[model samples]
Target: MSETPEKSAKASKSSQAAQPAATDKANSAAKPAKPAPKPKPEDKPFAAFINDDLLPALKQSLTERHQAPISLELVEGDRPVVGGNCWMVQGVLPSDRRFWLCFESDSITSGKTIALAETGSDPSLLESFLIDEKRINLALLQSRLLQRLNGQKWFGGN
Candidate 1:
């Protein structure tokens, strides 16, 4: 038995309305489950530079004529000012300049240390002797130390 046009139209509208609800149900069923949260990067084993060998080497290198052995601290985990896997070398110089060197690598990238004389003189000679590619070298540091030991005055010398 064929229905009247009005009844057929009403039936079609109801079926159309029901179709979206059925599709929604099917889509909800087909979706994959939610993924778990990822682990933090700091949870893994990170490189540390304050090992036995490195600490002594750094302390010896940073020590000055009158200054005591520099203290080394390993800054691990989250610290706003300090990054992970970083080392902080703090010491007081003979001239009273509180020096703080923040080594931000797993290994020693640069082994040189440069200091300006107290007089604030031209640092060109010092720079030329100390810096190579804007990095300090061992020879330059040794030379500077020797120069300091002698009575001769260099740039920024007292």
Candidate 2:
């Protein structure tokens, strides 16, 4: 039996729609979607940024410059200076010098402070960073840290 013109047109339309759906399924089976990329250090939460990117970069930088391993620790607690829970990156050199990079809060937007103490002494050098805290990045953190250490003649020259 021959189909009428209306039935033929309807069958054609349905076949055409089914063809695209089959093509889409085949294409999807052949190609998988890529996963999303990880966020950059500056884009991550403050603690994650510090632990993942900032500390590693700082340790590498300091170790390369000082010609020895540099130790770094992140301590979170109720700091007397901030009067609340704060984040501090404490670093130690082979020469027994210690430095603390303190954040006023667990946020990149918070202000920052620094203190450095020589061997067998209390923190003798304390100061607030002058840069905008919100603009911090790994490079900036490393630069500021080296600059402060250099200023104290820790690397032995001006």
Candidate 3:
């Protein structure tokens, strides 16, 4: 069947309009999708222990016992763990004396640390206590270390 010129023109015009809509859809699809936002991380056991428990007790004990400024820092990991978190502790007393402690945290309330080691300020103490590794309570460890550092500085005894 032969179509009239006007009818053929009208068909071409509609087809051209449809092409633009299709092109628009394709263009939109070609654009990159927006990236999803990162979720806020939940606290790990070790981090909670450091923040909620250790820092407070250390600060209070330092205040009451020493009457000197003491700096306690987690110089290492706070990664999530099943049993507990493990980290290295760096402590600085008012005399600017520095000590490093390594521990495997069992919980906020309990953990194990090397009370003395073969490498530190007191070489004699370290060598003597090297094989005497024991899991002392954190508070006891903290107090003992602070006292020991003071003793080394002044009284010069372990």
Q: TM-score for all predictions? A: 0.28, 0.68, 0.40
- All candidates' lDDT scores? 0.43, 0.79, 0.52
Task: Please provide, for model 1 over 9-80, each residue's C-alpha lDDT reduced to its tens digit, 9 standing for 90 to 100.
Answer: 999999999999999999999999779877533223333333443444444654544444424444433212
lDDT of 2 at 136: 74
Q: Each model's RMSD to truth, in Å?
A: 15.6, 5.0, 13.1
lDDT of 2 by residue, 25-117 (tens): 999898777888976678988878898888888778777777353678789864433346678888888778888888888876578888888
Q: Which number leads on lDDT?
A: 2
- Hey, what RMSD does candidate 2 come out at? 5.0
Instruction: For candidate 3, write residues 42-62 as lDDT tens digits.
Output: 223666656565666666766
lDDT score at residue 121, model 3, on the 0-100 scale: 42
Decoy 3 TM-score against native: 0.40
- Candidate 3 structure lDDT: 0.52
